[model samples]
Target: MGEKHRSRWVETLVLLVRNPMAVASSLVLLVLVIVGVFGDVLAPYGYNEQFVGDQLESPSGSHWFGTDDFGRDVFSRVLLGAEVSLRVGAVAVGISLVAGVLIGLLAGYYGRWIDDALMRFMDMLFAFPALLMAIAVLAILGRGETNAMVAIGIVYTPIFARVTRASVLTVREEVFIRASRASGAGDFRIIFRHVLPNAAPPIIVQTTISLAFAILSEAALSFIGLGTQPPDPSWGRMLSEGRGFIEQAWWMALFPGLAIFVTVLAFNVLGDALRDVLDPRQRSALSGKGAAR
Candidate 1:
C-alpha cells in the first residue's frame, strides 16, 4: 500500500517533469522568484541608494547593466523590482483564487437561483475591462502597491469564479461524487475532500496564468504613476521614466522591460505546460503506465 501510494505520487511528479516547456518555464520562474525573495542580499546596492557620479552610465565592466537617471544601479534596482512585481502578482492571484473558489463552490453546489445570481454577477464583472476596472479601483483606493494589488485581485476574481463554477458543475455530477453522496458524506466533507481537490488542477493552472496578467497589470498601473511611489524602484515606473530618454540611454528601459517580458512569458508557458501535465486524461494515462510497470 505504501509503495503503491508513493509510486502514484512519483508518477504524477514524473508527468509534470517530463514536459520540456513546463520544466524550462518552471526553472526560469523559480530563478526569478528566488531573486525576488532575496533581492536585497543579491543586489549590489540598495534600490533607493543613489550613486552620484554614475548617473546614466551605459553597460560596462563595473556597472553591468549600467546606471539610471537618478544614479541608482540599474541592475540592483531591477532585481529589487522583481520582488515588487512578484509580490503584487502572488498576492493578487491568491486573493482572487480564494474569493473565486468559495463563490464558485456555493454557486455550483447549490445551483438554481444561487447559480444564476452568482453567474450573472460574475458576468457583469467580466463585461468590464480588467484594466479599466483596476484603474477605477486604484483611483478610489489611492496610489499604493497594496491598493494596486487589491485592484488587480478584484479584477481577476471573476475569471477564476467562472472557471471554478464550470469545473464544479461538471465534477458535481460525476459518478464518484454521486457515490460519495450515497455513502452519507456530509456536504462540507464531500466538498473539501473530494470536490475541491478534484476541481483544483485546472484552477491551479489558471492561477499560474493569472500571475502573468497580474504582474502586467501592476506594471501598467505603476507606469501610469498609480503604483510604487518615488524612491521605491519598480520596473513599470522605471520604464515610464526611461521613455523620454530612450534614445540617449537605452539601458535604462531595456533591462527592466526585458525582466518583465521574460518573467511574464515564463509564467504563461509554465501554465500551459501544467495544464497538459495535470489533465485528467494525462493522469489516467500515467496511472495506466504505472500499473503496467
Candidate 2:
C-alpha cells in the first residue's frame, strides 16, 4: 500500500511538472511561502517604520513597491502581509477542514437521522452567500484578526462538509469498506485509515482552491475595517488606505492589488492542475489521447 501510494504520488507530480501553467503556479506559491517565512530578513525596512516625509512615494530603488500614507515601506509591508494572509487562510481552512471532515465522516458512516440533521444544518449555511455568512459571523464575534479568521472559517465550513460527505458517501459503500466492516474494524479506524485517505484527493484540491477564496475573504474583511486592525499591515488594509492617494501614488494600490491577483490566480491554477492529475478518468483520457497522438 505504501509503495503504491508513493508511486501514485510520484506519477501525479510528474504530470504536474509537465503542465507549464502548473509548474509556474507552483513556483509562485513556493515564492509566496518563502516570502512569508523569510519576510523579516528579506525586507529592507520595518513594516511599520515610518519615513515621515516620504509618504505616498512612488516605486524607487529605495522602496521596490513604495511608501504608503504613513510612509511605511510598501515593499516591507507587502512582504510581511504575505505571512499574515497565509496564516489567516491556513487557520481558517484548518478550522473548517477539521470540523467538516468529522461531521462528514459521522454523517456518512451513520446515515439516517444523523445524516439528515447534519446535512440540513449544512444546507442552511450553504443557503447564505459565503461573504455574507462571513460578515454575519463577524457581526456576532466582533472585529480583529482572530475574529476574522473565525468568521471566514465558519463561512467555509459548509463547503468542506458537503464535499467530504459526498466523497464519504461514495467511498463508504465500496467493497473494501464492506470488507473492513465485516472484519470487525472499529469505526474510527475505518474512517480515518481507509475512508479519509480515499476521500482526500478532492478535498486536497478543494483546499488549494479554498486558499484563494480565503485570502480574498480576509482582504474583504480588512478593507471594511473588521480585520487586522491598524499598525499591522494587511494587503486589504493597504488597498483601502491607498485608494485616496491612488492618483498621486498609484504604486500603493497597484502593487498590493497585483500581489492579491497573482497569489489568487496561482492557487486557482494549481488547484485545477491538481484536480486534473488526481482524477483517474482525466488521467486515462490524457493517456489515451497521448497514445492516439
- Top-lDDT candidate index: 2
Give me the overall lDDT of model 2: 0.90
Candidate 2 Cα outliers beyond 4 Å, as residue runs = 288-293
Clashing pairs in 1: none
Give per-residue CA lDDT, model 1, range 97-151, as digits (tens).
Answer: 9999989988998899999999899899889999999999988999999999999
Q: Supply candidate 1's per-residue lDDT for 62.
A: 71
Compute each candidate's TM-score over C-alphas. 0.93, 0.96
Q: For every model in order, what is the number of clashing pairs?
A: 0, 0
Per-residue C-alpha lDDT of model 2 across residues 69-165, encoded as one tens digit per residue: 8889999999999999999999999998888888888888889999999999999998999888888898999989999999999888888888899
Task: Give lDDT: candidate 1, residue 73.
Answer: 88
